[model samples]
Structure formats: structure tokens, C-alpha cells
Target: MPTKPTREQWLRHVLSSATLTDAIKVTATELFLEMRANLHVSVPRALLARRLGRSERQVSRRIQVLKESGFLDVIETGWKGRTAVYVGMFKSRGSDAQRVTVSSTLCEAPKRHPLEKPVPVVAGHRVTPWASRHITIGHLRHGVCRNVSTDADASMLEHVPSLDGHAWRSRTAARLTFSARSAWPLLRDTHARLAAHLHLRLRPVAAHHSTAARKRTTP
Candidate 1:
């Protein structure tokens, strides 16, 4: 009798199979990895969702695809609060000739789209286009000031003075300092702007009256 293919061999075959979609192949790979690591073929949908960074519903759909594709067989059905058990099918069914046909089909390379442009290569490495790799100032500004509390704080940090220049430049060091003396004016200006924007009434303080009251009460 022929020797049975090991789990690793089976996984390699499944991954290379052209009949299966990329999503199904990924799900199968995850399941195989789980089985190898844990010595069990039970993987919860929730676990798969977290591992794959997909919704549970999407994971369920992918699992269903694997089941329908004959890569996975349901050993035991899930019950209340219990996950289902599955066993991976590795051995090819039918005669040697039929197996050869299946193998050839699985090993066939996927066809490329006619309209798709070839990726640019530089020194054996693929170079991504500038447009795709570029990060806009708006994105950088948003990322830096995302944690800022107020609109005034956002406005102050939105655009760096150096970055606004005609020539593009990179800074080695950038620092922003705030002392009471410097920050007080900015705070007062912001308060005034906010008050004017909101049409808020400002109550005047009676500093002279308070000073006179303090003098009268003094020892």
C-alpha cells in the first residue's frame, strides 16, 4: 500500500491547489496550523474571526466554503455552547490516473488579468508607485492631533510652519514648548475667539471693590 501523505504535505497541496479560492486556502491553512499546534482539529468561529481579523459571519462563510470543497469533513456537530469537531481530508480518492489528473489541475498556475499592469521591479524588489506610498499632510496632521482636546489645539498643531514652505524639507528635531507666560496669551486669545463665536456674555470682575474690601478687613 502507498504511504499516507503527512499533514504538512497535505497542507502544501491544499495551498497550491488552483481549484480553491484564496479565502478558502487561507482558512484551510489556519485550520491546519491550529491542528498541528494544539493536536486537535477543533477551532471556534470566534477564534478564527480574531485570528483572521474578519467578522464571525465572514469566517463562518469561509469555513462553509472549505466544507463544500471537500478539504474538511465534519466529525461531530456543534451543540449548545460546544464547538464542532472536524477532520481534514488528505488522501486523494480514485485510481492513479484520476489522481494524476487532479494533481495536474491543482498545480496549474492562475491566469493573470489581461488589463492588469505589470508591477515595476528594481534590483529584484517590487517598487510601489509614489501615489500609492505617499502620505498626505492632512493625514499626518489628523494622526498627530487626534488626541487633542479642543479645536484651538488642533488648529495650532494642524500645519507646521516649516512644512508650509515652498521647498520640501525634513526636520531632525521638532519641539513645542508651553510656559504659563507664553501659554496664557494663547489661552486668553482662544477664550476670546470661543466666546465671540458662541456669542457668550462676559461678566466684568469688580477688582477695585474687592481690593477695598480686603484693605478694610486687613489687620
Candidate 2:
């Protein structure tokens, strides 16, 4: 039977990992939690490294660790003029009930995404813990990833066709792609409440290339 998670278990589950089995991942997870608590936007890797007292390379590696471990990851990468913008992944509470206590056994198998069965990967990361690979948390959901699939589009369209992963059509009801499901009812409730409060469930909604273009066509 599955075990209940305590606050520490949950934190550790999102923190310690195989690739980032060191101090960097630990600190990055702390930073992510703090950022989540404070709602910080993408501030750049250098700035984050400075704040964490680590080198930029260290921060970068650990961020990858955080991403693979399902704590934090990237949402979008784009350029405004010659400058690029990357939307940082921070687990924002959706509803009060959406947040649950962590358990003691963190290394235990993570439950499947509440909405999905058991997908090997999602976004760009492998979700299968036994697959001998590591994927980022961003690839799981947005903030809180319960499950992952090789194709987010396939995962999202369990109930209907996903419009051929044509991001534009898939953009609708983005967050709900991994909504509360039978996988973890208790955690789902906690997540729903947590997301409602933090205003971000798994991840934030997908970003549009241009807001004007979004309105010019039907999604």
C-alpha cells in the first residue's frame, strides 16, 4: 500500500535526487520553495547563483537537477527583441486542499499524475522512476507534478482529441491537463486548494507567442 507523506517527506521527494544528489539540488529546492512562497519571476541564473552562494555553473546544474526531480523547471523560452525571456517554474498553490503534508519515505515511488495513468515521460523528461533516467519537474506538471507522459498532448487528450499537439488548440484549459483525478484523491484535494490560493496548479497556463496573435485566431 502507498504511504502517507509528511511535510519533510514531500520536501525531500522534491529535493534529493540521483543526478543532483548533493548540496546544489538541496539548496535549489530551498530556493524554489522560497521563490514559490514569495512569487519571484525569472531573475536569471547568475542572480540566483549569487543569492544561493554558488557558482553560475553550479546553479545551472542544480536547476537541471531540480527540473529532473520535479521541483522546478522552465515553462517558456522566448526572445523579446534580441533578449530572451524564460518563464521560471515555481509551484504555486492552487487551492487550500491542494497542498498535502510530506511523508518520511521520500524515495518511495511517486504516485502517478492524478489525471494520467502511468506515462514514461512528459514534456521533455522521463516520468518513470524505474526508467534509469531523470527528468525535470517542469516536465511533470508546472509546479506540482503528480505524473508525466512522453506526450503532454496525448496525456491532455485522454477525454478527447488533442488537435495534433498544435499548441494553439492545446492551449485551452492548459492547467486542467493534469487535474484532480482518481490517482490521489486526498492529495488532489490538497492540491486544488493549494492551487486556488497560489494561483498555479501544476504549472501556469501555456504562454502565447504573441498576445495579439492569440486574439487574431480561434484557439
Candidate 3:
């Protein structure tokens, strides 16, 4: 018979695979691991909040984050006075047919990540944050950019499976605020600023260089 994964193994998988960076996520995952192997656990929000030293709302948000990131599954939702049931899950698959389905969010993640790499402009709109801010400022000055609430924080890219080819991004919400006259100049300035910022940030410092040199020069 196949044995269930130990807590340590499950935690290692979570850390390595999800690259989980938040304390809440870590704590929530730990709680999930304390449950039965089959993940037939019923944890209440208030109880979880108390255990983690967080507000119920915070715990709720953390649970949502876990679900969205493919760390937890909702086996059943609470209705009336019932508590919800959840199953602990990770991004791995077993050879057997009774494995948890991989999350679509993770599958779509790499292809559509907002900051995967620097994108200057897409569909005549500034994609970089600095450039987008500059465009917003320009519009603010002219009172032209309305519907500010509808602004998009990320670019939606077309999914292309080929490695040799590149994918095109859709027209971002920033384009909605743009006029033909100000569009080109705004994009140009934003791209220039972003490039300079990247250059400075990515430039090797003396300490890093010295460390590398020491490693190479050491006997």
C-alpha cells in the first residue's frame, strides 16, 4: 500500500513548488498539514483565526489565496450553520487516477504573469508601471483620463505554446485613457525611464563584484 506523504515532505513541496513567500500562507499550510491524510478536515474561520493569531477576515483572505494558488481545495462549502470542508493539496500529481486536478491558475500563471519580464507598451498603451503612471499624470494634468477605476494593473497576453515565437498582448486598460496626440510621447518617455531604472537596479554593485572575484581568486 502507498503511504501518505509526511508533513515534512508536504511542506518541502509547498516551499519549493509554490515559492510561498508570506507568513500567513505558511501558517495556513501548516494547519492544513495537521489534518487527516485524506484531507477530510472541517476547520472553522474563527477557530483558524485564533490559532494563527489573525482576524477572521485575514484568515478568510489567506484561505482564498491558498485556493487561488492551488494549495487548498474546497470539498464542500458551509451552508446555514455548517462549517466548510477543505482538502490540503499541492502542485504534484500521482500515477494513480485518484489525484487532485492541477490548478488552472498555476497552468496559466507563467504565461500571463504581469511581471514575468519587462514589457514597454502593448497595443499603443504603456505596460510598464512607471510609464503607466506617467501617462496617468499627463491625463490628470489635462483632465482627459476618466474612468480611472477601470485601469488594469496587468496585461492580458495571448497564449502561445511555441518557445521560438513570442505572444502578443491585448490592448490594456491604459489605452482607454489615451488620445492619439499624447499616446506616442507618453509611451516613449515611460519606456526611456523604465530602461534607465532597470539599468541602475540591475547593474552589479562593488560588493557583489568583490564577492564574485573572491570566489574566483580563492585557492
Candidate 4:
């Protein structure tokens, strides 16, 4: 008879599967460890949470995902004063039929797209592309032109200031407490100042020297 696969080998198979997220994989590893140490496959959510240093709710969510993905199955549901029992699936197939069915299902699990993966949270907050774009537009609208590194960026500075009266009035009212009449002139002045600043900042020093040389030669 072929040797039975050990618990560690079974765990490696599950972890190598692409269907589970990192959080779920961690949860699975913790559950597997608990089973190996206890010599049983009945890991409780509370115990897994404590071992993984995560909240019980989070552990439950990960367990749910594992169960849905066929990596885990509930042997007994927990009730008042009773802990649930869970068995890791695909550990040992009793027959060829069972092995074939599980292998096929696991292999057919939908692969996640790269773009659909969750972005890493920073400082307990998520910064989305839309939010970043809005921030960039706000900076452009305000007279901050230091980030205008390309012709497209420079054009946006002009395009933003040239919005129609209705849009300009609404946006200004939303961003400031001042009335539209006062805000329009202020916005125009700010834009004019930014344009003049960019003009001076972007003008080549060599062009200035050439202009001076041309003036001296003419005299």
C-alpha cells in the first residue's frame, strides 16, 4: 500500500493552491498547526484566533472562505456551551472516486485576476486611484504647479481654470464659503500668478543669455 500523506504534506498542498488569499492561508496554517499539535482535526475558531493574534470575527471570516473553497468542512456546528468541530478536506481520500472529484474541483477553482487583488492598506486607511486623482486635480485647481512635469499636466492647469461659469461657480461654492462673484476673480488671479511663475521658472537660462547677446550685437 502507498504511504499515507502526512498532515504537513496536506498543508503544503492547500497552501500552494492559488484560490486562497494571504489572510485565509495564514488562518489555514494556524488551524493545521493546531491539528498537528493536538493530533486531531477539530480546531476551534476561538483557539485559532488566539493563536493567529487576530480577532474571532476575522478568524471566522477566513474559516468561512476556506470552507467555501472546499479546503475545510464543518464536522459539527458549535452551539451554546459547545465548540464546533472542523475537518480539513483532501487530507486522505478513502477511495479513487473521492480523490478524483476533489482534485478536479480544486483544480477548477476560479483564479483571481491581478487587478482584482486587494491593495495594501496604509496607516489603517486605503488610498484608491480615484482619491489620488481627485487630490491631484485639487492641487492643480489651487495654484500649486510644482508637480506639473509634463505638457499634459501644464495643459490641465489651463483647462481647469477655463471651466464653464456654472461648473466653476458650483465647484467654487462647494470648496469655499465665498460667493461665486468673489471666488471667480480670486481663482482667475491665482491662475494668472501660477502661469507667470511657470513661465519664469521654465524659461531656459541659455535663452536669456542668447537674448542678451543678441541685444548687445544689435547695439
Winning model by lDDT: 4
Arrange candidates by TM-score, descending.
1, 4, 3, 2
lDDT of candidate 4 over 110-145, digit per residue (tens) = 977677667887563222322122224346556332
lDDT of 2 by residue, 1-219 (tens): 995433454455454333335565556555545443223335566667777787866665655544544455455552443322222343333322222212212334776657556766645633343222222323333332333345532343212223322342234335434544543454444445544533343233324445556788866
**Candidate 4: regions farther than 4 A off:** 36-40, 91-219
User: How far does residue 187 in candidate 3 sit from its true spot (Å)?
Assistant: 59
Off by over 4 Å in 1: 36-40, 91-219
TM-score (all chains, Cα) for each model: 0.39, 0.27, 0.37, 0.38
For model 2, the stretches where C-alpha displacement exceeds 4 angstroms are: 1-10, 16-19, 37-41, 78-219
**Which structure is stronger by lDDT: 2 or 3?**
3
Which digits, one per residue and each the tens of the lDDT, describe model 3 over residues 15-100? 55533446645665656556776655677778877777888776666666666556678899987689888776766544222322
Query: Weakest 10 consecutive residues, lDDT, candidate 2?
Result: 95-104
The CA lDDT of each predicted structure is 0.56, 0.44, 0.54, 0.58
- The global Cα lDDT (0 to 1) of model 4 is 0.58
Better of 1 and 2 by lDDT: 1
lDDT of 2: 0.44
Winner on TM-score (2 vs 3)? 3
lDDT at 199, model 2: 39
Predicted candidate 3, C-alpha RMSD: 32.1
